[model samples]
Target: MNNFYKNYSGIILLLGGIILGSIAGLVFGKDVVALKPIGDIFLNLLFTAVIPLVFFSVASAIAGISKTNKLSRMMGIMVIVFLATVLISAFLTIMAVRLFPIHEQLQALKITEKIEDKPLADQLTQLFTTDEFYQLLSRRSMLAMIIFSVLIGFATLRAREKASGFVRFLNEGNEVFKHVFILIMKLGPIGLGAYFAYQVGVFGPQLFGAYAKSLGLYYGFGIFYFFALFSVYAFVAGGIRGFKRYWANNIIPSATAIGTCSSIANIPANLNAAKKIGVPDYITNVTIPLGATLHKDGSSISSIVKMAVVFALFGRDFNSADAILLALGMTVLVSIVEGGIPNGGYVGELLFISAYGFPPEALPPAMIIGTLVDPLATLLNSTGDTVAAMLVARFSEGKNWMDVKEAA
Candidate 1:
């Protein structure tokens, strides 16, 4: 009981906070907004720590890569696999949201402060880069900062033996920020509770609005994608036999992913499953571990849904081509920064808040969405790594690579 409580305490507190806040709102009505300042304290702390957290976590994850791992062809193919799967996920989620809008009463719910309607060209420029280095420090520049972090990581990679100290600093910084997040979350019950009260009181039914539909859509898609899409990926990699091999050996990895709900935890299971399913050792060696940190088809799906719900809550049209294009681009960047942080979804959630100029209040709902969808999302995230290894092997070897391996 103590062990279980210790492990699940954060999630328990968070949900308890929301439940208590909802009750308070029901009892007290509009006066609940008075409690909002307390919630704002939590948001402020998260926003302050989040930028540095992302910088160090992302850079450190990439810099930790040892150049001695000479699986260049496999690595290149792995990049293609990661990006392609995430793109597909983002689009599919976008389509799902488009076909079944998360919220119906957009005009009534739109927030007073909105992101300025910039020309597409200007929006693109701002989204991708900033004029000054200091600008990257802001959450509004999260996408730009992510790009910058990736560049710094690659530069460190280029420096090789000379960059060891800098890499160590990044790792230490990441550890520091991780603990900071822990301390901040210690305050989550009070903060999230107070905020939920304000939302329920001020917005009425809007606090509970569309979250049910959104979560339902996510779970449905996750299940369908898990069985149907994975089989397709395996079939593509190795033909009918490849499909058979994947499903045959996938049970343990899938079970571990579902039970643990941590991508990193599922790595050994994925590596073992990949080996059994006939992935070349070199491909599995490079892809599964790295994929735990760098690739995230499931996170990609959740991101778009979370963004769409935020848009709906703020009274924006997420289905617009421009809105969706920007969302997909941000989804890619979020997938990069999101994978490497501890309690990492906070960075990705805040990225949406900052990038879209959503008020700080927008965060809790996104965090809630992340928490709700995490299990199935992790299932995809971990399993996808093994399937990706199979794809990399297919490309790196030949059409009959699995057959060739078996013959030997």
Candidate 2:
């Protein structure tokens, strides 16, 4: 019993948090505002760990790459897999919308918003960073840090003897920071409990009913995407036995993704899951982190569903050939930008309106749909990450790689 409880504690705590929090919120209403500090503290700790972890982990992974050719091969394969998963996901979402049409009135949920326009040149500069060290300090610049860290890793590799100590320091720092992050995660239940409660209190029933048609369609198709699409990816990587093994091994990451609703927060769990599924440490380290930032099948599909809903609300024709192509394109762009942006998926829906030239009135409904499906979006994103890592292992390592000891 103790061992069983230990094994399932995170899931237990998460469910307990959501249930009790929801109850408390419904019972206490606005008074639930008192619980915000508890959730805030936990979220702040998570945000604190994100930048250091991404920097050290990715840099160490890249620096450790012995053959530069292999890095390119791995990246090339990974990008192909990521794009395939996303495009297929978007296609499925479109089919789902066509199969079960959503019809509902958009509630007037008043919310003000703005998206800052950074030109292509500036975006490129920010991605690599003109001042690498300064941009690393900026919490918002994850892409910049990733680019800078990879460059540093390559530099360290070229100057191995001279940079050995620095690389060692980075590896050691990664271990230390990872341990600290785990320590912080020990408080996840308390933090998530309060946070879940606040969410329920603030937007539970009202939001659900307001966007029920779209939310229902999003989740319904989301389930199909998760089980059906993931199974296909697993089967492609490994046959029947391998497919079963992957799913069994994926429990931790799956639960973590659903509970946290943030792929970044789900990385540690994904790492463990990757190892259980027989991906080597080297590949897992690089692929999972990169996947967290890039593999966003969930957001791609959800973006389409949100667009369809917003279009329907405006009596706009979403079935037009131009709209279909626009959604496909926007899905890719949005998935790329979704990482590390605060409330990014919600804000990303604005692009749907802007892309289709919809009236400004469509923004509120888009926000509503996006916010409601955010958790499932994270699940799809993180789930795809774990699968992508396994696929990388299969391509780079071999099929026999995953047939080893099952993931605990």
Q: Which candidate leads in lDDT?
A: 1
Q: TM-score each candidate.
A: 0.94, 0.59
Report how far off residue 230 is in candidate 2 (Å).
0.9
Compared with the true structure, model 1 gives a TM-score of 0.94
C-alpha lDDT of residue 319 in model 1: 70
lDDT of candidate 1 over 1-408, digit per residue (tens) = 685555456677788988899899888999887898999899999998888988988888878876654776677788888889889888988878767777555433545565576767887788789999999988788878888888988898889779889988988998898788879888988998898888777778655656787898899888888888888999999999999999999899888776666788889899999988888787788899888887888888889888877887776677778888888877777777775322456667888778877888789888888877877888888899898899888998988989878876
In model 2, the runs with Cα more than 4 Å from the true position are 1-67, 103-210, 340-342, 403-408
Alpha carbon deviation, residue 199, candidate 1 (Å): 0.3
Candidate 2 lDDT tens digits, 162-224 = 888988988897778767766765676677667656755765555445467788888988888
- What are the candidates' C-alpha RMSDs? 2.0, 8.5
Could you tally the backbone clashes for each prediction?
Answer: 0, 0
Spell out the clash pairs found in candidate 2. Answer: none
Clashing residue pairs found in predicted model 1: none
